[model samples]
Target: MEELLRFGIVGCGSVAAFHAQAIENTSGAVLTACCSGNPQKARTFAAAHGARAFDTLEELLAGPVDAVCLCTPSGLHARQALEAMAAGKHVVVEKPMSLTLEDADRVLAAARQTGRKVCVISQLRFQPAVQAVRQALDAGAFGRLVCANLSMNYYRSEAYYQAGGWRGTWAMDGGGALMNQGIHGVDLLRWLMGPVTSIRASVLTRAHAIEVEDTAAALLEFENGAVGTLTGSTACHPGYPRRLEICGTEGSIVLVEDALVRWDLPIPCPVPVGEGANSGAADPNAIGAAGHTLQIANFVDAVRNGTPLLVDAQQGRQALEVVLGVYASGRTGRTWHPETP
Candidate 1:
């Protein structure tokens, strides 16, 4: 049997519970400690997982742990990840890796310098349906890729933003809807379609009275000549199912609510199925937390067997680059290429 990997979880919030459960359930991983700025929450989170609690990350890092899972605010990701890496702990961080590309680069550099593995929490990639779609695309089932469309229309009440001091702020959470919620779909789009060459975008705060834009739409031209449109927003009432559609000369595939809602093509596509996989259903609340266990499972395997990380730290930064490119394009009112930076 592989040796157990002790894990220290920083940030004892709602999302932290998911990581705790995932670590507890995965083989060769033990949730040894939990940390939070709030002492009470940290204690509660640790008790729930049968682990010790610390009021700060420094205390958690002082414990015996092989890795740290950071579920902190988006803006704080870089600093916390770097600290964990510097402590000689492997890190798995929540997405949008950092608020800016520079911070993202810093985190990546730290990982390299420390010679420790760093992974970004992009659990959407673990969804069986999403994996199936990626397989089809990789197998050329989507012959001669043409165009793609991605939409993320989710509602976040004022109470949601006010839940945490860093919720809707640009400095912390990066952007509003695009950074917080739509980033998964955006990353999935890029993962399946390939690198974007240029982007033309428009952004606005349509509904939420936040500093960042609550709604954004963009057109992208891929280096491979494929065109795509992306819409992200928190403006819709009650919200709607996030959807991603990719079309090629042969046919198209649509994934709605994490499931393959539509698959129209003549190609013999093989579906890569897995056990205990979440059915890609359309409940907004259901999809977000469902993939954590699978993600942890994969991470533990990678740690033990030296398997490649499911979502490497650099790929996470690349995904952030695409989102930032859209913002840059929106600001400049001109198509921006990700490669330029």
Candidate 2:
């Protein structure tokens, strides 16, 4: 039997429960300790998971744990990952790895310096449907892709943002719709379409009273000569599922909510039949824990065997760059490239 990799969960919020379940689900891991700013909540959560509760980060670091999974707010990820790595623990963090590309760089740098593995949670990439799409891209099934798009439109009730003080803040939650809600699709877009060259964007807070935009639209130019559009919104009512459309001279494919709803091609496409492995459609927290479990399983193998991760700390920055570029273009009312300041 493999040795157990004890894990400590930081930030005892709603997402922490997912990590806790993942830890329970994984074979060679255990939830040994949980930390939160609020000690009572930490204790409450800890009791349920049979973990020691600590209010402060320092205490958790000093505890008997081999790794730390950070479920903190957006703005806090970089700092927490850096500190945890400095304390000599492998780090796993939730998405939008950090609020800015610079912070993402710092987190990756810390991981490199410490010689510790850092896994950024981007489980959507592991979906069977998405894997089929990647295979199609690699096999040139699209025949020099002409256009691709990503749409992450869902409704978050006014109360959803109001429920948490850090829900919509620029300093913590990053941007509103694109950063918080639509980013999973943002990551998926970049992963599928390849590196983006330029983006012209328009953003606004159409529905909720928040510090950031609830809706954003962008024109994307890919490095591979593919032009595309992206729309991310939390203001759209009836809470629609995410959709992605990709077309080429040869054929096209459409994925609704990560499921391969439409597949059109002349070539022999060995596409997977049935629903996708992800259901992160309308409700943010409604998705299954299988993705998290798979990623955690991979992270453990990486930690034990020095294997590489598909979504490393460095790769996590790409999606964030796309998002920041959109926000920057929205600010200047001009097209933005990552190379541009």
**Best candidate, TM-score:** 2
Show model 2 residue runs off by greater than 4 Å. 266-278
| Cα-based lDDT for every prediction | 0.83, 0.88
- Model 1 poorest 10 in a row by lDDT: 273-282
Report the number of the highest-lDDT candidate.
2
Q: What is the lDDT of residue 320 in candidate 2?
A: 90
92-145 per-residue lDDT for model 1 (tens digits): 898878888888889888888888888888888888778878877777887899
TM-score of 2: 0.96
For candidate 1, give the lDDT of residue 48.
82
Segments in model 1 whose C-alpha atoms lie over 4 Å from true places:
269-285
